[model samples]
Target: MVAVVTALVLLVFIASFRFYARFLGRRIFADEEPGFVTPAHELEDGRDFVPTKRPVLFGHHFTSIAGAAPIIGPCVAAYWGWLPALVWVVLGTVFMGAVHDYGALVVSVREKGRSIADVAAKVVSGRVRLMFLCFIMVLSWLVLAVFAMAIAGLFMAVPTSVLPVNIAIVVALVIGWLLYVKKLPPLLPSLVALVVLYVFVWVGTKVPLDLADTGLDKDQVNLTWILALFAYSAVASLLPVWLLLQPRDYVNSHQLVVGLGLLFLGIFVAHPSFDAPAVRMSGDDAPSMFPFLFVTIACGAISGFHGLVASGTTSKQLDKLEDARMIGYGSMLGEGALALASTMAAVAGIGLVGFCALPGQGPVEDLSWAVYYDNWAHASGNKAAAFVLGGGAFLQQLGISAVLAQTLMAVLVISFASTTLDTATRIERFIIAEIGDALKVKALQNPYVATMIAVLPAIVLATMRVADGDGGVREAAWALWPVFGASNQMIASLTLLVLALYFWQRRRPVLPLVIPMVFVMGVTMFSLVLHLLAFWAEENWLLLGLTVVLSSLILWMSAESLGLFVRLLRERRAAREA
Candidate 1:
């Protein structure tokens, strides 16, 4: 069952990319200028805007945007059932998510590589751009703060990951030197780095470095790691694209391929059964599947964050304008592929490979997939760890050692998050510079100043002590996740709105973009209302207030977009009559 289902989902992705994507390219976004130079060449600075080959840029783009969300989102969303998670991820990435990402990349490339937020000034109005920038800033702030905490926590849980992850960084630096300075070919160096990466993955198992032994409590160690991670990301965000970000992400992309291949290959061999339900629509404990599922399984299907990454960094590195379709659409499919494997791991793969069963369930004959997902709370408890356990189990089927498999999975999670952390910081830097230009603050426009401003507050958010359950202190920024999903989707919908207007103004077919835009926007608005109610009932006024503000801004922007479309239609009608 696992093998067949996996093959079917893979087919959907392949077919969608082959047929659906081509239809989109020719019908909707037909403005591709064959000989046009991109901003990567027009504005090459050796730092942020150097032209890059498509394969290399695709790696950078994919890793930066993927992070752990694609894995975490689907794994957690399995609460409803693997069926809904799988269906949404596959369908969403194909129709809505890939379109959202591809549209933003193409639009940004045409607009001189300005972020979608900045491009808003051209598509709609300057004030709308301001509103968009504010949204970008808040989302970025939450991403940095939340991801730092996640990586720190992972480091504590999987101490074996500490060494290999760090080693990958050094390897990335070396690979960067080889690629850019030495002018070496990319394929051999990257392939070699991947092999070296796995070697250290094995070594990490033998030399696990636990921070708890250093005489600090869990919270203290977590905070220390968070601070250190921010410092590293700050430097990473400021470095030239060739030095660290690009080459490292390229390597991480390869890591993702190997990691994914393992999971799928495991599903094929193990052929696990579904211990979880096919369509778990309701439980007394689970949230309704209608709107929440859309947000819960957000990143793999359609994500606002992907649009940010596309316009923010990837747009500046296109070696050719044609690469947008492949990089933009292809990368989203890559993410969907990851999400699919994770869903299988949570459901059938884990059931076949085996998991550390629930507290009382243990390793009994009844230890099916349901033992791990019998309750919504259990499924939600440890998202990435669940994937690692199941995926690790799958690896074990291939004769890999349990310790090595788990360490490899842990390293993949940490690497995905780290790439996103630095990339988000860089995007935030761009946002800050754009914000500075808006406010006419010349100082904030400086890249150094912008990056500093971006990382510091995030560090404080991630490391700041707040009341933990029962009385201990912890970072409060992790609280932002509930709203982050909805807001991120909102970003995607609005990006589509911008694209819709871009096409509508030029007398092109917009139904393709509009369909997804409307659906995403509708679900996003619905999900935000539910989030607001939950926060209100829980008396989480901070989040409630934030949701209200975010909702109001989205509504205002929606209205603004509507007015622009209304005027455009009127003008078109008048021209038709004339």
Candidate 2:
């Protein structure tokens, strides 16, 4: 079943890229002028607007948006079943997610590489531009919390991954120096850096850096790591793109592909059967799979964050109009594949008997799908560990040692999360600076100041203590995920709205954009409403507060966009009558 499912997904991805993506680039976007110049050429700054080749830019874009969410979302969503998660990932990416990305890239490029938020000023209204910026900033804020929490938890669970993950930064730094400063061909240096990174994976096991050893309890240790991770994000954001961010992502891009290849190969070799049921719709503790599944698996399917990475950074370096299809649409396909692998990792029963303790429970003597996913909280909470351990078991079938296979999988997870962490923080810095210029706040316009503002709020959120069930307190990092996912889907839906409005104004065929727009918007709204009520019921004031603020933004901007859409229709009717 594992091999069959994996092969089927690969086939679908290939067909979509070859046919569907080509149709979008040529027909919908209508890129007749193959020689059309892009922002990378028009505003050729060495720092942000470098006219990058398709392959290199694809690497940057893929790794940036492919972050921990794709891996974690699908695996966690498997709390319901792999069938729902897999179907959403495969179908959603092809129709909605890829199109959303491709459209955002095209529109932002047409608007001279300004972010989609900035572009929203023209698409809807100036008021909407500000609203969109704030919405994106807040989403980026939640994003920082979610990914930081994920990385911190993974580090705690997979202590052997700690050392290699840090050293990957140093390795990336060297790769950047070689490519940008020393002017070397990228392939050789990138391959060497990747090799160096895995060698450190072995070394990491021998010298694992466990934060618990530093006299802090588990929660304290998680907070400590979040703080440290934010510090790194600050620096990564402020640094020039070519120096650390781009080259680091390049290394990780290769690292991700290699890791994923080995994982699937192992799955084929082991041919593990599914341990979890296909359709799991009922559990007293489970949220409704209808909307929850969509939000839970946002990134690999359709993510607003992908649009952010699309317009926020990727569009700036787009070398030409035609490249948008591959960079924008193709990368989402890559993430979908990542998400698919994560789902398989969660469902396969390759290592069925290992014992691991869940929250509020001792180690289960006979670990399996039932034990690992005994409830919603544990399934979602330990998502990274589930992927690492599950993927490691797959690799062990390929003759890798238990420790090494687990460490390798850990390296894969950390590498994915870290690249996204770098990109998201940089994007948030960009948003803060843009907001500063709009508001005429000189301090906020400063990059250093913007980076600080970007990092701090998330630090507070990631470190906050929330009252958990059973009269105990817990770190609020991962707890932010529910709000984060809802906010994520909301943004995706809004991006679709922006795209739908863009096409409607131009009087182009808007069905392709409208269908997904409506579906994702409905899903986002449904999830947010349900979450608001549940949060209020549980007295989860933090989550409730966040849901209220974000829901308001979604509703407000949606109203504004709808008004514009209606007005545009009236204008068309009047013109026809005249």
Candidate 3:
């Protein structure tokens, strides 16, 4: 609809403003003191620190932030009432998401590209850093496990999916080898590999998965696969970037950009109306609106996880101080755009003439209607009517079936889930190594040993839970949402604290620090409480126990922070301490 066109334009404008404010407006600071060149600035090399073009960084950042969360959250949250989900996504991204992401990257760059945990150590103490690291490790484990199962589930769903993914991985490996080992031109090989991968996807659908009389339990087998997958992830991450990480990201980034463009084009041409009811129909089974909704949709609006990506991977690569704004702010806006695309997809099925009004459920419930009980835009007449309304304009122009277009949309959702699994696994392995090294356990420090130690628990938990008929790993995935949200927020809180530290040392304005710091802390703690309660209610005593342990660590650190803040404030009052 033209209505959606206006929304898209507005988002682009807001995103552009955020990018400019972050980078180009570096001269227009609220206040400034001495020019402080942090380690990242001092250690700049063109390899990592080369100034990235905004468009290139846009692709990089967008692919980094864009993942299953945006897709899955929108699809599920749409069941709530698209309006709330829509509002939260659009408004929340502009204010909270962009601010959190952009600020984190900028702050990390200022601190010489130290990770959030490292920053916390400097701002707080070595003990706090250790605690933060441990918290992150545990959370990373959950993220890896959840995504592992998710990717496997996607593979199982399509039956033929294995072929496409396998081919893509192989193509990536070939490209990696040629580029790194043989010193081949990266761009050409990457392009050729991607084309090969796409052809394989089409061919893959032709091959059968032998589903008939298959004896394996999908859930049980999936859990086992997740464990085995982590073992591989451990090995992969421990190796140099030329081996796996950089190559995959490079190929995946191109794929992501191309795929996203195609999907957007399909949507533009299809002109699907919002068919689902704007309101979500609720039942007694639904959890309390407050906690459930907040947890269900963590990454789309604002994720603490974004802080980790910003501070850990991206910050270290900043070529210039100004690049922080473009890479940070602009990337987040891309994520918001993806969220908006999902929201619009959900809304597309609404309000079609001659569409026999059926009760709309699933993703459409949230945006178009206020209450769950209202009339919804059903898919039947909705698609047909849009086709008629467009008078063959869009279809004739795009030359794509609306239904095939929808399938492509779904594929993108699954791809995000798959890519996230790979990324999450790599990160978790690093966390495991860090924890193991800290504990000074030789066996634990061994990559294989640590990976097995980390993966087994999740596999058993996923399997046993599934065997017990609780939807297995799928249900356990729910338990993970809050923990992921909190851990990410905790990272954000730490990042902001670093910014505050830099300002404090430089004798600059402290109000900016106070605002974000307070809000993130509140949201983080609230999320932690909700997660703990959910674990206890589910009678997941093991996780419940782990939650208690982690909470104790986080609370102790938080209390320590408060004490430090108070002492600092008092010290400032006593003497204008910079």
Per residue, candidate 1 scores C-alpha lDDT tens digits across 499-523 of 9999888778999899999999999
* Better lDDT candidate (1, 2): 1
Worst 10 residues of 3 by lDDT: 380-389
lDDT of each: 0.86, 0.85, 0.57
lDDT for 21 in candidate 2 is 88
On lDDT, the stronger of 1 and 3 is: 1
lDDT of 2 by residue, 67-96 (tens): 888888887888897798889999899999
Off by over 4 Å in 1: 353-368, 464-475
TM-scores of the models, in the given order? 0.96, 0.96, 0.78
Candidate 3 lDDT tens digits, 113-196 = 666776777787878877877887676666666666655655554455556665555676676678757978667877887787
Query: What is candidate 3's local distance difference test score?
Result: 0.57
Highest lDDT model number: 1
Candidate 2 runs further than 4 Å off: 214-216, 349-353, 356-362
Q: Kindly give the number of clashing pairs for every candidate.
A: 0, 0, 24
